[model samples]
Target: MVEQTIIGIDVSRDWLDGFCLPEKQRFRFQNSPDGYARLLEILQGMPDDLKVGFEATGGQEWALWRILISMGINTVQLPPAQIKAFALSMGKRARTDQIDAELIARFMAFRPEAGRALPDEKLQRLRALTVRRAQMVDARKRLSAQISACRKQGVSAELEDMDSILKAFIETQISELEQRIEGVIAQATELSAKAELLRSILGIGPVSVAILLAEMPELGRMTATEAAAMPGLAPMAHDSGAMHGKRVISGGRRSLRHVLFQAGLAAACHNPVLKAVARRMKERGKPHKLVIVAIARRLITIANAVIKTGLPWRISSAA
Candidate 1:
């Protein structure tokens, strides 16, 4: 196992700041094709044992990530928060893109399994569609709320009409997006099969399936707790030296968690299996919110089991 070159990049719209460890070199390049080419040139001379790292700066890193992955260069997309935390732990109070790039490289060196490998091309497409759907859903919710307010306040007829038109448009857009999502799933055999398996569970609909398939790509790769934690659904205990504290959920894919929570609501009402789990928790005097979280976690567990086994869900009567 030869020592690898760990390179970190802080990507921006117009520029990229990079730091390469083991070689201790830094490069600043334009965020353009020319810059991408130069970065590749540098990698060409580096050891074959190379690991590139960068933060997931929204979509800014996507181009670079794809480029590196396509070039057969190892790349990892580190979470910004985790890297920030790592910086503070290192007692590096000051910050800059250059510093961040360096920290990312070091973090990768410290934690090799800190980020995900590039996902399948279909998974990437699913993610884009699902994310857009989430945005559309949120917009729809806001517009609905505004429409309700207009009705309550008896707003002018023209204003009400405009609101209605906008609402209808958003709804239509959402419907189209739903169809596209379905098509994307059908285009891939693995995705289509897994989606069919997921939908076999009561209350897991198309939207839920899209979000899970896109955001939870590691669905069949880990244990139930690992799956739950990826979406921040796991109950994290806070206890020390007999000084117990409340358990709270934190630090996972927020979008995944949001979509799962929505599904949990439906599953709690319609899925006999999950309803039983929720009922038991409620009977144990747990709050409604906690019960919902438990249901979400259980939903993830069942989904994980289904995908791992390549089987559709059988409506379980026993808890």
Candidate 2:
């Protein structure tokens, strides 16, 4: 592969700033198709191929990414936190839009693989919807807390009425979102089929399936342990040299972790395999809740296996 020009894109709501090296070409555009066309026109003259990189800013960056990807231009989407950390380590006196763009460009130039670009329009849409739903769910929780406190303290009638209204509204909105999520899944043949496969496994359901489709489309793409680690459920050693300690899990996708914990709860109640695991753990004197978490992790392992091998779950009563 010929070495190409490295370009960093600083993206915002209505405009984007691009910086390139060697010739030091910099330009600002309207962040529209017309603007993207202009930017591409400038990039077409590079000596080698073109490598474009940018940081993730939720859905704000999605349009530009889609546009670039469709144009057959190689694009790299860096995690925002990773880029921010890179900036901190650079030891720059002060930061500007240009500085951040330069950092992204530098990272892309050195560690080209740090920029991972997934070419999935449907998956991208699902991810956006699922992430937004998570945010809404969190907001609903906060609002519910406020309403609960108002009722507990026997606040004014008007306050109670407002709280009730808000709670109802949030619930309605959540229901609508849930229905739309199912619709989105049903519309995508591959995703819908995969989701159905996921649901066939014990402890996995519509919501969990939706999340798995969005956050981890790579379940079957790797080993069970690898997938579990991505969701932050893989067990890790917590020992200190000579000091013996338990294995604990750390640093994974919080949403996936949450879904697994909830699914584990349901699985422990009904999934024969997980129930057996929970029983064995309890026999070993494990804490009740901790055993449930263990069951969740095991369920995750099984789920990964099912997705990978395209096999239905078989609960062996002999076990």
Candidate 3:
């Protein structure tokens, strides 16, 4: 049997700190084209069963990740939270780039299936557009709030004018981003089909479809429970021995979770099947928030079933 060589990297804007297990080798390279070439050269000398892993450091690790995958290297993006938990489990106290690199490598060795592979190029582009759109929307929201406050306080006319101009610019940018996102999805046959299926569900708008396809690409391939869990909508139990604790959710894609909550609000009121589910839960005296969460979970579950079966959401099948 052949052994696997696992390499973990601590990525930053300017540098890549890496540690290799089994060989116990450490290396550092600049985060540049030249650095990528040097790292590729080193990787070429390794075993055929090589696995490279790194924490998702925002956009900093993207270039390196793309280059490595393009070169046929198996790369995975580890969640930062998982790495932190792994560090604590190992009884590690001090923190440094090199130490982090080692911890990531060790974590990879401990759990070989722990990270996410890169989505395809088109999905990547869609993810970028949706993220930018969200940022613009957030900026516009904040600016609008300030503008309202200023009106109440009777702020200077010049300040109000500037605020209005900034708000208009942000809205324009958001519109452009949405157009780009739609274009990206429409151009891809698979994505377009998936979008159509997702949109068949009432209360799931274009924005919701774009986010689900971009952030949770594993949608159709996962079980209904996995679908709910991926967006942190699944209720987690906290029972031990004789003491039962409240069920709560934690740790999933935050962006996906936020959008689902928004979708859930609409689903609870409008989605036929889901609205009934919400009504029953409400009649049972469930909290408003819990009812919404249940609706969100059902929404994703229906989405998963729809996509998996390659059928539009029908009232009979979805239920």
Q: lDDT-based ranking, best first?
A: 3, 1, 2
Residues 86-192 of candidate 2 have per-residue lDDT tens digits of: 77788765766777777778777767777667648788778877887888888899998888887889899998888789878878888888888888899999888
TM-score of 2: 0.81
Which wins on TM-score, candidate 2 or candidate 3?
A: 3
lDDT for 147 in candidate 1 is 87
| Residue 313 miss distance in model 2 (angstroms) | 1.3
- lDDT of model 3 at position 55: 94
Model 3, 1-319: lDDT tens digits are 2157999999988889999988889999998899989999999999888999999876688888898898899999998878888888889979999999999999999889889999999998998899889988989888888899999999999999999889889989998999999999999999999999999998789999999999889999999888988888888999999999999987778888899889999988987888888899999999999888878888888889889999998766545
Minimum summed lDDT over a 10-residue window in model 3 is located at 1-10
Q: List the residue pairs that clash in candidate 1.
A: none
Instruction: Give the clashing pairs for model 2.
Output: none
Residue 221 local lDDT, model 2: 84
Error of 3 at 257 (Å): 0.8
Candidate 3 CA-lDDT value? 0.90
Per-model TM-score, in order, reads 0.91, 0.81, 0.94
Q: Quote the lDDT for 241 in model 1.
A: 97
Off by over 4 Å in 1: 1-3, 91-95, 145-156, 317-319
